[model samples]
Target: MTTDHLLYLCFWCFRSIFSVITFSFTSSVFAQQFDQQYLIWKQQQNAHDLRLESTLTHQSAEAVISKKLEPKQALATTGLSTASERVNINQANVQQLQKLKGVGEKKALAIIEYRQQYGSFKHIEQLKQVKGIGESIFLKNQTQLAL
Candidate 1:
């Protein structure tokens, strides 16, 4: 072949090889970028899942603590008495004294009013000042009642 033709062939082959190398390098770089992005996304998702799990655990712990606290609060408020136990007219408030078997709202209010005017009861007999309570009711509840 002519020298000019041979030179032209060599030039074309060199151009093709350069183009292939450039394309391979570009493809490798793009693939590496995609892999890095995928890894970052996976890490973010894992972190989000961990946060959600921790929040749920905290909520459950709060619920359990609330459940445990409720009975203690009830015991404190009710003075360790069951519903059947007679309430102390002297020490009890209007709301607490009203929970007694025979006591109603009016009686409860009357007891508070009498206590406020006359001060603390010295004996169970002082409860007779309340409207509904008489000798018989006081006698009946005397064993269960307190000062």
Candidate 2:
């Protein structure tokens, strides 16, 4: 072939290779930019979800705390003896009797059952008849007891 024709063919081949390399490089750069944008969006979504979850958890905790602090209205509305008064042997429940000093759940239930089967205690001395009570316990709580 002629020298001029050979040079022309070489120039066309070089131009075609350069064009392919440039196109590939540009596409890769665009793909990388798109991946970075997608990552940023996903991070923002995760942060938003975490914030919503935290708010819900705080609200539930506040609801539980408020319920615990609320007073029991049944005892208040009955217009019976106040909470500070000595527990009535005739009418006191196990829960109420358990508030006394040194009284546990079993002792409180025993006191209630004794009152139910027999009758109201006429005096503090009668409390000794219960299984758990003795002279020392009666003496210690005598001032706090009533008919």
Candidate 3:
């Protein structure tokens, strides 16, 4: 084969190998994350993979790992709850709201104020109506929310 052809073949081989490894790596992380997500998904479980299905095979392992880990860091920082724990927007106190991914004191207060104004949240989806929350934040906590 030509040098360029040989390099191309080798590149494809490595790419395939890396893709396979990604599934393995992400599976291990997912396993660790699973037990935690399980409880939450149980309460908020949807056709959206209550069975613990993962889409990591389509993504770079690094990206998949980072995305999964991002939401839990704040919960970890507080050292008071499991990594998969989610705040109940309807029942959460300021401290609980602050434990969520992007919420700080101001955002937590906004959430409480919103809850009071609206009464109990009609659904987890209603969190999007809060001042600082949007689709992205709501989507990130999909498993953590409850009705």
Candidate 4:
């Protein structure tokens, strides 16, 4: 072959190789993005399934509770009691404390601990001294408190 033809052939070969490399790199990047998107979609689907499962479990528990108790008794015993029922802090037990708004098991236990550590509650305001019982919580249950 002539020198000119040889140069042209080499140039074409280099261009072809460069094009192949660029195309391969672009394809790899796109494949990575697709993989990431598929993973995210799968994770979201799993979360949705978990939420549905939780709803079903809660419904099952509620069905059992409804069968067990009269509606009024069920409400109170389930810690969904009305705020109308008065609870004397001095006289109330762990179960009674749990019935109050925002008073979960931990808070109920804290109240019992405080009552046991200190003497009986002299004033309704003393409830504010308990851990987790801030001003708002104390105020909310103030109406339902007695000596």
Candidate number achieving the greatest lDDT relative to the actual structure: 4
In terms of TM-score, which candidate is strongest? 4
Q: By descending TM-score, how would the candidates be arranged?
A: 4, 3, 1, 2
On TM-score, the stronger of 1 and 4 is 4
Candidate 3 lDDT over residue span 1-147, tens digit each = 899999999999999999999999999999989987897777676646533434332333444366664534533543445745766778988887876677789988999899889899988888899999988877877677765
Models ranked on lDDT: 4, 1, 3, 2
Prediction 2 global C-alpha lDDT: 0.74
RMSD of 2: 20.5
- Whichever of 2 and 3 has more TM-score, that candidate is 3
Q: Which residue pairs does candidate 1 place in steric collision? A: none
Worst 10 residues of 4 by lDDT: 72-81
Candidate 3 regions with alpha-carbon error over 4 angstroms? 1-84
Question: Which of candidates 1 and 4 reaches a greater lDDT?
Answer: 4
> What is candidate 2's TM-score against the reference?
0.44
Which model, 1 or 2, shows the larger TM-score? Answer: 1
Q: 1-147 in candidate 1: lDDT tens per residue?
A: 999999999999999999999999999999999999999999999999999877765655565576665543444443444534666777888777766556777878888888889999888888887778888767766776777
Q: Write the per-residue lDDT of candidate 2 for residues 1-147, one digit (tens) a residue.
A: 999999999999999999999999999999999999999999999999999877765655555565553233322332223445576656778776765666788989889888888888887788999999878877766666777
Model 4 per-residue lDDT at 16 = 100
Name the lDDT value of residue 110 in candidate 3.
Answer: 95
